[model samples]
Structures are given as structure tokens and as C-alpha cells.
Target chain A: MWDEKETDRKLCIICSKGTLDMAYPGLVLANAALMEGIDVTIFFTFWGLDMITKREMSNLKFTPIGNPHKMNFGNRTIGIPNAVAGFPGMTNMATSMIKKEMDKLEFPEIPEFLEMITDAGGKLYACRLSTDMFQLHEEDLYEGVEGIVGATDFMELSEDAQIIFI
Target chain B: MTSREIAGKTIEFDEDGFLANPQDWDKDVAQELAHEVGIDELTASHWQVIEFSRSDFDERGEAPTLRRLKVAAGVPTKDLYELFPKKPAKKIAYVSGLGKPHGCI
Candidate 1:
């Protein structure tokens, strides 16, 4: 029902975590918004920058340690008792299980989904502060990344957009 | 019991104008339905989306979500968004002569 480009709705997503669980929430919502014709921009900062950095993209892991939600089986979950999270190899086991399930479902890997979203016109913004602090070069980021932008620039770009912190 | 005349055929529609029987839809009917929904013309690309949506409904027995369109129908998100704009699921359902979307209104 939108008639004008100037009036097009925009969604600005802030990804502050690099965990696989956190990454999907933002990417899925961003893709859904783009499918609905809403302009979308994802700003990655701190650990979130790990999601876009080429060297770290495939390494986004699921950490069961300290997570209140436990590993779920088909019907039930082995809710992590905080103490049990410290057991040797528990986090790695959980991560492997999640990856297996993702593979079974044929979900595109993190890098592929990021490319998909960008190909669909969703803009990916890397935080300049995070880049400088982490010593990340522009070449180290994914091909989809539009640029390294500061908080001020992001705010200006998102002035008319709904900001979603994920 | 509302009905619309499309391509010289009397087509039944629900009160909300969704096709009462989606099987009655054809490409010609789609062009007319598209216009009723404010889509002035149906390009080949538009037909791709509409056809994909209708075929998906036929196979799935429900309106296809925009997410499914991207994943299964192979319609790029940029194309889907540009073709249907805000709320592609509902708009595509309307133009494709399918029922209203069950999710996300």
C-alpha cells in the first residue's frame, strides 16, 4: 500500500551479540521485513561484529554455559542446572547438537544467510568503534557489509527507521 | 456471495474479495484481480510471483508466507518486496486470487 519511496518504512536492527542464537533472531526478522518491502539495515557492534567478520563468521558458536535454557530434545529439554554448565565438553556438545539440527533442516549457514539478506537489499553496517577496538580491517568483513559506520552515522541513517535491538 | 466479473467470467468471492474458489483463477483473471487491488499492470515478473503463490497454495493448501516465497518459491526478497511492497503475503494473496494469509495478517 506504500505509494512513495520517501514514505517507505525502515527497520534498523542492532545486533550486540555474536552467538548463533542471537544472530538468527536479527537475521530472520530482517529477512521477513525485507520480504514485506520494508527497508532494513543491520548494525553490528562489539561481539556482534564477530558475526560479520569473514574470519569469525563460520565460528559463531552456541554456548550452553550460563544459559538458562537448556539443550532440548525432540520432546523435552535437559534444562541446564547452572552448575552442570561447567561440566567438561558440555558447551561443545550443545553447540555440535545445534549445528547438527541446523544442518538437518537445511538452513543456509551464517555466511550464506548474510549474503542472502544483502542480496535482497538489506544493508549490513559494521561498527567503526568495534572495528578499531578489534583491529578489524574493512577487507576482513563479509562481502555484504556496506561500510564501517559510527553510532552517529547509524543514528542519522535510522532517523526515520524503527530501531530494533537484538 | 459476492462475485466479480473477470475476463468475462463470473467469479465468486468472499465478502473480503478473496476468491471463493481459487481453482477458478487463471492468468487473465489475475490481471483483473491485480487491478482491483491497485496494481495497474501485471508484468512477467509479477506473473512469476502470482503463479508461484497460486501453485504453492495448491500444493500446501494454504496461503504461502513471504518467508516461504523466498525459501521455496525462489522469489528473491528484493523482488517480492518490490512487487508487493508492504505486507507481501496479504497483497499477493489478494492479487493471486487466493485466500487471506493466516499469519501476520
Candidate 2:
């Protein structure tokens, strides 16, 4: 028999990408879970560590290269070719466009989003090996990060919880 | 939808228990809703959030998200969690008789 009340629902989200588009999904999911009274833990590894690195968190970029979706500008849907998207300033342009759209929807910046999650009781952790590979220290991470932990520690922390990899 | 007697008045609720018609809310109904969600008493702090949410909903026709509550209503996110416990956004909306917040954040 299923016992809904006896089960304390939990969610563990693994963020492995650093791009601006990649970052928000994990964050938004974590925030939504916390809003619903579920326990949430987020693990940052690989390029995703950029999401918590103080120097890079706010400056994360979105690259439209290889993405086939057409971007809507006012009433027009324009698709950027891979070649054009790879031009020098294209990344910055794409990043700013995405940022503007996100702002219009009232999504907070990366650091502020992390603060909201932490304040709402969501847990954040950096993957130890990734931090070492990237030569990042505890001080380099956002203040809300709990700690740097290995895979095993993350497993223990996320025990009995549903897992999401982004 | 389901109907329940809360605070001596019959109230209609949606599938998730949010008020079907937000107009069917009053202070007494809010108190009972808060109690149903494990809040024993509606303290000044709790009422602060509830009142702000109701008025915000009235203007926007939607419940305020935690960020809106913090930025617009001047309630801190930390205080909201403490007041509403685990689910501040949904709890505040439920108690305020507003629809669920649609934004992911």
C-alpha cells in the first residue's frame, strides 16, 4: 500500500551545464520544489560549477550555435545560422537577448536566484572533483553553497530522493 | 471541485483545495485555512503576508510569487518560509484564497 503522508518527498537536481539556458532549468525546478514543501538538493559539477563561481555566475553566456530553434523578435521569427552564431560578438548578443527576455518574465539573476533557494531551505553543493579540476576554492563559490562534496557524499545526501540531471 | 464548511460558511475549492472563487474569502475563512495548513494561530507576521497576497491578487488577478512577495510586498523570503513553514508560496496563496502562482520561480 502507498502511504502518502509517511513519505517525505525529496528532489536532487544535478546541474552539469554552464550556459545561461542550461542554468535556469535546474534552478527553477529547485525553487518550484521548495515552494511545494519538498526537500531539494542541487549538485553542481563540470561546467555547471560556473553557476556558483562568483566571478562567472553573473556573466554566464548563452550561445545559439547549433540550436535550431527560431528566435522571435517582435513579430518576426528569425533563425541564426550556425556560421553567423559563431561570429565574434554573436554569443554576447544572444546572451543579452536571452537576459532581456528572462528579465521581462521577472526571473532573478543567478546569484539572487541562489539566495532565494537557500533562504527557502533548498540545499546547494559543489562537486569536489570538478572544483579541483577547475582550480576553484570555497571562496570562489556563491555564499549560499553548502560545501564541496564527492559523489558518495552526494549519494548519501540525496538518499531516497528523486533525481534530476540537467 | 469540492465544497467544505470552513469557519461556519460553505466554501467551494478546486481540485487542489484552492478557493474556486477567490471572492468567497474573508478573515474567518483565512484563519480556518491557515489552521488546516498547520498554522495554529494567524500571527501579525502571517497576516501581513496573507493581506499582501490578497491585495496583490486583486490587482493582478493572480497570486504573487515568493519573489513578488519579497520585492513588492516587502516581506523577506526567509520570513515567509518561517511563517508558512515548508511551502510558503502555495500556503500563502491557499490561505489568501488566490489561484496558484503560474511562474516557475
Candidate 3:
């Protein structure tokens, strides 16, 4: 009597980059699903696992190294050869603006968000391979993290659930 | 591809940089919604809201309404008052595709 396609179960696999924006969607989606009366799980992998780690999670930064988003939109829009945007301060400006906007929304900081996930019924798992590569231990993750899991385990959970690679 | 198709559901740019299907929303969804509309390129601070919004949901289990967002996001309402100068937070959230818009989600 269970319809797989119509099932409300969802799974989110978050591969967080150092970019905080990149990291937030996965957590938000996962918690949202849970709140909606759907079952949810989250798998943190790659740079995303940094959120669970101690030394690097809070210190996450956006480096200028090879960042394609910083390219000038006008050049791309007009078919120019990699012409950078006229506004040199665009990046900094956008960053500051969003930060202010977020502050108004009363969004929690990273550490508190981790606690929110645990307090919610959602499950948090760190990627075993990514953890090993990063030399992270269980202590590096937030308290609610279930454990380190491999891709196979991740896929198995995602089989019927919606999988989001954040 | 069309705006109508994305009416109610939240559409976000995922870690992969594609138009992502957030599938669900929390407080972070609001900021992500803002990111979707305001700027094409998001800075670290922009992403910080995304993280915080999600975290807010992780703790609270639901997206904060307008008033809560004002407090949780940490920006003085006056600060945002100056930034948009014209648009209200609800409009900003709506344009950003934060909650169930009108049809999709």
C-alpha cells in the first residue's frame, strides 16, 4: 500500500564547498522536509564535511582562486573574450549585502545550525572517504552526526528518497 | 525553465552551481531565495545566510516567518531598509523564491 514515487521520504546528500551559501541549502532542505512530515537524511561529503569538522568548518572562506562566478557578466552576455566586469567591488558588495539580509532573517550561525539538525529528527552522516582524506575524527563532527558512511551506503539511503548534492 | 513552473517550490543554486531543487525549506531558504533573485554571483556572506537559515531550521524545524527572519538573520532592519530602500522583506523573499510561491511547491 506504499507508493514509492509518491512517498514523502527525502534524502539530501550535501557536498559542501567552502562557500557558505553552498553549504546552507542542504541543511535547510533537510530540515524543511522533516518539518513537512517527510522523512529526511543528510550526507555531508567533500568540502561540505568541513561544516562538521572542528578546525575548518567555522573558518570557511571564499578564496579568489579560480572562482568563475567572479567573471564579468557583461562580457559573457555580449560574447567578449573573458572581459571582466566593470565593477571591481561587486564581489565584496554582494557578500556584504547578503550578510546583512541574512542577519535580518535571524538565521543561526554554523554551530547552532548543527545543533538544530540534531534536535530535529533528521539524521546527519559524514562521508567516510572525505573524512579520511581530511583526516577528520568523530570529534570533528557535531554531536548528532550518526557516523561516517561510504558512497554505497549513501546511495542505498537515497534510492527512493530525493537526493540533493549540495 | 519558466517562472510559472517554479511558482511555489524553492529553486536554489546548489553546490554544483546549477539551478537546484531545494525540495524543502527552512529559514536558510529565505536567504537562498534572496540569493536567487538579487545577485548572480554569491559572496561568502551571502552563503553565510544560507547556512544560517538552514541551521535555524535544523534547530526549529520550520522556516521562520517574517518577524523571526528579521531577528535571526542578524542585520538591523534599518540596514535592510537602507539596502533595498524600496522593497519589503516579503517581496524580497517572494522574488527570491523562499517559500511555496504561488503554484509550484
Please report, in order, the local distance difference test score of every candidate based on alpha carbons.
0.80, 0.89, 0.53
Error of 1 at A123 (Å): 1.5
- B1-105: candidate 2 lDDT, tens digit per residue: 888888888989887668888998999998888887788999999998989888888898889889988888889889999998877787788888886667677
The digit string of per-residue lDDT tens for model 3 on B1-105 reads: 322123355455433232334344444544444444444454464444445544554576543443354455764433433332223332333433333311101
DockQ of each candidate, alpha-carbon based: 0.33, 0.54, 0.04
TM-scores for the candidates = 0.79, 0.93, 0.50
CAPRI grade, predicted model 2: medium
| Model 3 lDDT tens row, A120-163 | 45678888998899888898787778998998998887788876
How far does residue A166 in candidate 1 sit from its true spot (Å)?
1.7
Per prediction, fnat is: 0.31, 0.62, 0.03
Instruction: Give stretches of model 1 more than 4 Å off.
Output: A1-7, A70-74, A99-107, B1-3, B9-20, B37-44, B65-75, B79-89, B101-105
Fnat value of model 2: 0.62
lDDT of model number 3: 0.53
Interface RMSD of each: 5.7, 5.1, 14.5
Q: What stretches of model 3 exceed 4 Å from their correct place?
A: A1-7, A63-97, B1-105
Q: Tell me the lDDT of model 2 at B90.
A: 76
Sliding window of 10 residues with minimal summed lDDT for model 2 chain B: B96-105
**Model 3 lDDT, residue A15, Cα:** 64
**lDDT tens readout by residue for model 1, B4-42:** 578998988876657888888888888877766567888
